[model samples]
Target: MLNFLKKNIALAWAKRHVSQTENFKNNAEKLQEELLLSLVKTAEKTLFGRSHQFEDIKTIKEFQDKVKINDYEDLKPYIEKVKRGQRSILWPETPEYFAKTSGTTSGSKYIPISKEGMPFQVKGAQSALFHYIAKKNNADFVNGKMIFLQGSPELEEVFGIKTGRLSGIVAHHIPNYLQKNRLPSWETNLIEDWETKVDKIVEETEHENMTLISGIPPWLVMYFEKLTEKHSKKIKQLFPNLQLIVTGGVNYEPYKDKMEFLLGGKVDIVQTFPASEGFFAFQDDYTKDGLLLLTNHGIFYEFIPLEQYGKPDTERLTLKDVELNKDYALILTTNSGLWAYSIGDVVRFTDKNPHRILVSGRTKHFTSAFGEHVIAFEVEEALKSTVLKYPAKITEFHLAPRVNAESELPYHEWFIEFEEEPANLNLFKEELDFQLRNRNSYYDDLISGNILQQLKISKLRKNAFNEYAKSQGKLGGQNKIPRLANDRKLADLLEIYKL
Candidate 1:
């Protein structure tokens, strides 16, 4: 009864929050200006501010003209100073801690998390849940335990500032009042070995009233498999109250059917766009076509057209200026003192009034070796359609272009680890190639002109991806496999397991 009452109160608060968010959305342009002014005023006293002459910035146009778009490489020097315990380098005071993430091209990164910015990160996630509950009217889900499968909360001092994976940092700071409703225990969560930690989580939550589960889809699939194995029944049978599955980190379309089958029953699926930089967007409507951007959050957003991305003196557009269905690389100026920082993700606007968007792909994750430019969104769509048409299930896969100097044509090389192998592998390959060609006009043109050969598929040993991730020290918790690579680096890595 107490838990029910608590859920009702929380639901009421969430509804109110959503109502306020709607107001902000309606007046987004005004809110955005206010947010920009506040950020500029606050950051004007920091070292970066003094160097960039933030005091001279009184308008949005001035702010943009003064600050250039920056990648991680540009901030490394300032971040190094912060790492050495320097005060007022970026933020007004020293950062409370740094959130570490595995870089796509570089080794690793330490993103500063200031005291003021921490709440924004936390609020972004909470707002997502609030929007979910408001849309579905499923407050009862909060009556049971919510298991967020994430990394260990253990922290290491990086030159006096505490640092760890962003999820770990967030997990460590979950609100005290709500701590009892979450799992696994701090001790269980701190276990470094993923297999062991999952075992502990299964043991702890197997008998509990688990209403909601949130994690990357692959990890959740692994956990659900273990639960079903232990109980000799599906997840729906073990946890009768399970209501929702929230996932992010990787595209879920490829894993949707497999996850639903493991669950034993249909459940609400919420997609989120969270990264080490910030919690950006979440599924707001039941259709799930796109995520509604959190406008009133402590972040200002800009978009650079994908075609103009690397060019000198490229134009940047704000939310008011973006057009629907055009891909743009996302840039953020946050209250955390990151000014005009490119977050490396690309997105396309789907709705103008509400400012909803679909994540297209990473800025660096595309292939155009033979004029057949392919993005992750197209690849995922093609794979999803092909899988539905076939009888196979994929455990993991990677796509890369294979160029043979001696050969007249280069071809796409696909490394696939299958959960259920197709009865006719050749037919499966043909259908996949057909789907890709249909989805990407450039690919179709190239194939018709004989500029590129049909894609080649190589079967991989079971757990090939897991083994590869382990070798790279990114076995679990928010780390993801790059689905598309421009070169043969990933292909060469998977070659060892080819059958």
Candidate 2:
């Protein structure tokens, strides 16, 4: 009964606060204080356990004063220690689950999130739906089967027990309060699990009354392309109730047009920021970006300047110190027992107090091919702008930088697949190249023969991403082709069919 009352009180507080954006903004100081108080409790449990690491209030103040910034790489060993049931200088208790990342850039990163931490992630996702419904003035559509296209559900056993990947693990923990009888099953793969079920997992949603679809942008885009090719006319004949699509994990620019084509019209779309570690944020309204902060119900936050990310001299700042439009690397001390932990994402504040943010990119996910210094968001924007000039027929594209042996500079290469041929293909590529070079100074210098050579375009095979994903042992779920490759090794493989 006490737990229920506590949950209700928190929910009521959230409802009251979120309903008034102005209130949230104005009360930023109070919110920061409250967040710090809660964080101190979490920190005390972890850092100053029964033996009392802090010992006195003065030491606690000193600890806060001297807090250091950290990254996921820094937290891995601590997480492992906690997983083994050892109390660390941070977490007072052991973590319950280890969530697995997509492993898109490198090997998968496993994040330890506790049962207490899970509620925040789940509530944040659901609140986005509420926000969407409020925006649409259609609260009636809140209950339905939300098709989540995630990884295969194969659990690798550790210590003689069975456990699935992060997505699967989270799905298994979904509370009964939010579930519907008709909820969309995790259909990426059910058998053979993660390691081997790539081919066996099917992409058919023919019979399901899918009301909302959520997954990584790439797999969703590929799935929509296949739907248009195989069951274009018969879509209404299959899932007649399909309504909204929620996508994240990667950029959405390339697949926006193709997705609408398959849906037969512009279906309402919501983007989200859910890592294997947590469901961080969501595009509450049909906005171009997202509204975000830590769930008030769970995690606590600290910030460090973006420029200070890899530097050893970086000092951590509390929420009180943050400024709007400035980039900050996040330091999280969570209910799950992670302290001063950096999740590796770089973000900037979009609004103050009410606390909305936009994820810029990972600190490492950049293209400096010949000093171009192109970030992921820049590349996504360039492609989005280029696609706007073309007919709505173009579906998807991927960009990479290729180094030529004969030329002095590296070139920007694009692989595009369209629904129909453009009126003038050469004009399209030329304009795209011009715009990209003009928008980014680095690219312009390259084009001026000061640095890099030229830009190239490639026409991918129809459903090239699908075939590529299949070849990589991926099912039609959240995983998709990378939009930008930062280095020469990955870029060479992407330049095969130059247009």
Q: Each prediction's Cα RMSD?
A: 1.8, 5.4
**What lDDT tens digits, residue by residue, belong to model 1 across residues 39-135?**
9889888889998898999888999988999998888888889999888888787887799887866568889888888887788878888888877
- All candidates' lDDT scores? 0.86, 0.61
Give lDDT tens digits, candidate 2, residues 97-207. Answer: 666655644466657666677766777677676566556654323344556655646666543233456666667656664466324345444643332332222244544
Global lDDT for candidate 1?
Answer: 0.86
What clash count goes with each model? 0, 1
Clash pairs, model 2 backbone: 154-193
Best by TM-score: 1
